[model samples]
Target: MPLDVESLRSHFPSLASGIAHFDGPGGTQTPRVVGQAIADTLTGPLSIRGSSVASERNADQAVLSFRSAMADFLNADPSGIVYGRSATQLTYDFAKHLSTGWGPDDEVVVTRLDHDCNVRPWVQAAERRG
Candidate 1:
């Protein structure tokens, strides 16, 4: 079945403004449902994720729910899901972790097509390993 572009776009209220958004690394506009969820969470009782208090429990549940949803969508384990502030941060972290296992014989390959954010982390990690 062909995907309905209009139907998908309808969920994003920002699209109605007719401004084309080509940037994803800087962060894409949130869909109405996601925006509403974020607003609700921010407006609701919030505390560090824990089970000691109601606010803490609420925060904990939000984290678990986000991880669970991501896991389901990615077909991965929820426990393995590590949320980062951005793709660059995650790339840097993973590069550093993986570089620790690298030896002199191992090579680090980065393409020119990769964004600077993606390339710099690997290069830095390789330098650190050396």
Candidate 2:
């Protein structure tokens, strides 16, 4: 089924204000569930347990849950999905790893249309590796 816009809007607390959200290209507002999940991860009972087997299990479950949700949303292989602070950072990190397979004569093509966050990191990585 197609996503119900009204229902999806209801899930996001920030949308209640009817604010103009033109900043989506940079970052979109997160839903209430995302905020609560983060709180639970940081402050819930599972986080308080000191190296207990149950705590480890809970942490593992949390990671698996996050991965599954991301895979579902992106229609991607969960193993191929990497979590990072931003797409720019992730691409830079990937470039560093990939650069190891390249040599001094190899060239990396980057475009000016990209955001500085995306461009600068890869440029820095290429320079450092070279």
Best candidate according to lDDT: 1
lDDT per residue as tens, model 2, 7-28 = 9788777778888574333346
Off by over 4 Å in 2: 1-28, 46-52, 83-89, 111-116
Model 1, TM vs. native: 0.74
Residue 73's lDDT within candidate 2 is 96
| Residue 122 CA displacement from its true place in model 1, Å | 1.5
CA RMSD of each candidate after superposition: 2.9, 4.3
